[model samples]
Target chain A: MKVTVKLFASLRKDRFAVDDFDYQEGATVGHILASLHISEEEAAIIFINGRHGGPDSPLKDGDLLAIFPPVGGG
Target chain B: MESLKEYLLARAENGLIRLSIQAWAVQNFGLTFPAAEETILGLNLLPARYQRNQRSLSCGQQLSLFRSKVAVIGCGGLGGHIVEELARLGVGNITIVDPDTFEEHNLNRQLFSKLDNLGQPKVAVAASRIKEINPAVTIVSVYDAFTSRNGSVLIEKVDVVADALDSIPRRLELAEVCEKSNIPLVHGSVGGWYGQVTTQFPGDYTLQKIYSRYIGERGIEKDLGNLSFVVAMIASIEVSEIVKILLGEGSTLKGKILSLNLLDMEFSEITF
Candidate 1:
């Protein structure tokens, strides 16, 4: 079960500058966070392909994930 | 290509917008089917119960669910306008949390700030105005200031959050809430003669990049009332971002920062 992952804001620093991630089957959102080396606190807003699913949510095949960190401006 | 407005109006109708909506379709969309028209009644019809109030919200076929709860972290210059747009659009529920109250100095750009409201709480004043404009909306007032402890109180139970704050610390704090809650945060900021808006839905560009590369650390300062012009402009864009996100209509500033400078009236987008 391959799933896509995305990283944003402060969490972006832990991985590639771009927002991209891929993980193996039966991996929890938390597992992907660990693979990307992002702490639970750092990796905020986990979207399983645009839905509001969290680390505990199971990832399906071809799932384009997104993760954004906290930001303050304006 | 359909312009942003046209795109949203496609699913809208002339009634009370319940949930899952983007943009202000009732106030904005053209009437396809005609309804009754009187002195106060517009093209749309409010539910009979609310029709008596006259300030009821317009309805639509679907309630663009993503907009169910909109928490505006501030209620100042820009936050005022953002609240107005959200409420008038029948956003279902609007929660405005602001620690400050109206002052004589806030008269210039504050939409809900009037001479009589000079000493009133911003959240209270703004919510009252929203109620009068559209009683169908549920206004949540957080008279207390936004902080790490109270972040969940305001951020939770909402589908999306908008950042129209004044300082770096507050914006960052709210951002943390949206991040942890797995909610998309549409962030905006303005300086003298300039402002910017962006959307961070957990999997997009980080706030640090936008702040460091573009905004720098310039604090909000008063400069010839540039706050109103820039705030109003940015707030409109913030509403636009909110609408698009709610309706799943089109693209968003997900990984981009939109910059607008009144000095030259130039607007552009940058990907970082």
Candidate 2:
């Protein structure tokens, strides 16, 4: 299965902004973050196909995953 | 009242009343400046302070803005700018909350922070600044944090709340308070060149949805260090949302988030 991954804000530093990669059928969001060397803490919100998804949420083939970092500041 | 209206009409300059003239009315009629302003706006005459807002906002809309009350949480980067704009934009009543004093580090972005007043309370400085900008505005300065205990009272009579807090947990607490009170919250946050804004109505739970996992008191901004322009931009957007809410004009970021990256110049509207 293949999934499209998009990173935003500071998460794009020294990393690809958007790309597609092959993952196992049962791959989860946490798996993709780990592969990208991003800790779960660094990924604040995750969206799969424009809907909120969790790190433990499974990704299906042709899924478009987007990850954003926490930007809470005054 | 008829005499005052006639005087205002006679003194009007091209259907606009100057603040100095309004001050004269306030002195003669023994009325507050805002009261005089309300009378002027009621007569469909524009306040000179809001001259630039004309055409963009009719006299009726300006009157509504001058009659609205808004609470701004935190007096840091976002809060300072938010108060400045709200005051200049003629928001009648403003409640500013912050427990901290101006620090050396805040001078970079906090609008009210200056080299001369580092140790002064943020809310006090904000109140004075609001008066300097627009005396018609009534300011409520709170010298304390917006905790769950005080949040309800702080926003009890407010029509709208702007979240300028820096802590995730505190933002969540504010959201809960506004939700319980059924007040709309215009939320903005910044980190370096990145910022995001969203308007959440009562029961929306958008804050909880966006901030549930990040309750550690801070976010990426702790490392990124918020820039001046990012804070100002997000603050302006938050104020715009507040104005829209007050005047019932234009669409706002009600059910979506506007995420901006100044470095990349990318703006994305994400719906949740």
Candidate 3:
């Protein structure tokens, strides 16, 4: 299965902003993060198709996965 | 008491009142600048300082802004710019809260920080700057950190609140307090070339939902540090959100988060 992945903020420092990658069937968000070398700790907010998602949440083909880093600064 | 409308009409230059005249009216009639400005706005006369805001903001809307109150939590990078914009936009009452003082490192992005006032409190500097920018805006500076214990008192009667805090835990706490008070919170945060803004009305749980799994005092900002441009941009967006909430004009970021990547200049809105 393939999923479109989007990264935001510092999460895109060395990574692509939006791209697609192949993952095994029934792959979870955690699997996608691991594949991108993005640690779960650095991924503050994750959304699947614009709604909140978690690491344990499963993804499907053609799904849009977005990840954002924490930006707690004044 | 004299009729301020007649007095303002007499001094009007092309139907626009100057700041000097407004100041004179405030002094002579013992009226607050906001009161005098409101009178000027009531007569369809513009305050020269606010001329740039015309068309975008009508006289009625400007008068409405002069009657609103806002509370800005944290007086650092985002807070300083927020306070400055609110005062210049003629927000009538502003309450600023921060416990930290200026330091040498804060010169990069903190708006109110100056080399000579390194030890001065951030809120104190903000109060002084607000008065200098727009005397019609009243400022209440609190030289203390915002916590759940004192949050209610700090934000009492405020129509809107802006979250410029640096701590994730504190942001969550602030959301809780605003929720209880039934106030709208315009939240903004910046780290390096990235920033995000969202509005959380009562029970929106936008902040709570955003930071649900985050388990840290700070975020990527600790590693990337903040830049001047990103801080100012986010602060301006937050101010716009506050203005919309006050005047009921324009679309706001409520129920959606505007994620800004300044490096790539990409702005994406993610709806929750």
Candidate 4:
């Protein structure tokens, strides 16, 4: 399956927003995260389909994942 | 008397029990502030006696009620922690300004540093992090360094400002702008396992005075020490001062500078 990965902050710096990526059909969040090239320790928080969800959570075929880096504000 | 103190702390909202259970207990009890005295008092503890932490931190809640605008300039080691604290504490609106791209070195403690974010712009990363923490908050990011050109505009936009900058020149510029705008500003820094913070309202204490009086004019040292924990401590202190400014109680560091050497855990405050 294919998905659109929108990255922000440091993640955005690495890749532009709305990047196209391939994911396994009904991919578990873990798999989609892997496709986005993010690691568990480095993952700040993952949002599936614009809502907060855990990593082990599953994903649909065309889910939009927004990934952000851990943040400390000024 | 306890009710008076609550009023003093600006717990003006109805029923002002907004204070954490711990702090409410201490405030209501005649026992001294933060009293070791058993709660033998408030927070739903009927006539029964109880012992627990005391003092009012409800300042954050009330401060949020006023919905002050704050600008946090930076999102790395110091900036990262500041953002997290402010979001959870519920500041009305916060604008973050940072132009640097996330780097590998930031991983040790920079809030937004992750292997996946190795090259992401800090401002956007930090902005998204704020959203995750408190979506209700308004967190805007300027993905550029705070140069003299844009610095003043940014200062003009926010009601209060916080300086978590790394360089002395940048810090000075920010401080001066805050002074000109008459905005309350909280300043913090970390180096060699040491961190210090100060709250300066307009016409109070200029950043220059604090820097030269204590830390000196040196820029970055050859090898900076652990900054994670130090930054966190300084940030919380910064947030506390912001809370004080918001709730309209407690003395701020306006005319004072607080310096800490985390190595031996020694802290001193100097008035300018």
TM-score of chain B of each: 0.75, 0.97, 0.96, 0.74
So what's the TM-score on candidate 2?
0.98
In candidate 4, position B137 carries an lDDT of 59
| Model 4 vs. true fold: TM | 0.59
Q: Write the per-residue lDDT of candidate 1 for residues B1-272, one digit (tens) a residue.
A: 66433443454455432223322333444421111111012324343333333442233312442137788988988889999988766566788999898998788788998988888899999878886776656788989888888898778878789888877656766777788788999888776666678899875635644333223223424322336777788888998898777767779998777756566565655555
Candidate 2 segments exceeding 4 Å error? none
> What lDDT is reached at residue B94 by model 4?
85
Best by DockQ: 3
Q: lDDT tens digits, residues A1-74, model 1?
A: 66656544334343653444456777788888777777555443456665655668777688877765433333
lDDT string for model 4 (B1-272, tens) is: 44534433343233233334434545455344222111212222211111111144443343342266778887777788878777765565788888789888788788678899889898888888877655445777888888666888887757678887777667777877787777888887766555667787777654655343223333323244446777788888888787677767788887665756566565756455
Model 2, residue B108: distance off in Å is 0.8
lDDT of each: 0.65, 0.92, 0.91, 0.63
DockQ of 1: 0.07
Model 2 docking tier (incorrect/acceptable/medium/high): medium
* Candidate 3 local lDDT, A1-74, one digit each (tens): 98999998888877888998999999999999998998777888899998988899999989999999888988
* A5-66 per-residue lDDT for model 2 (tens digits): 99999999999889999999999999999999988877888899999888999999999999
Who wins the TM-score comparison? 2
After TM-score superposition, what is the CA distance of residue B217 in candidate 2 from its true location, in Å? 1.3
Q: Where does candidate 3 chain B have its weakest 10-residue lDDT segment? A: B1-10
Candidate 1 — what's its lDDT? 0.65
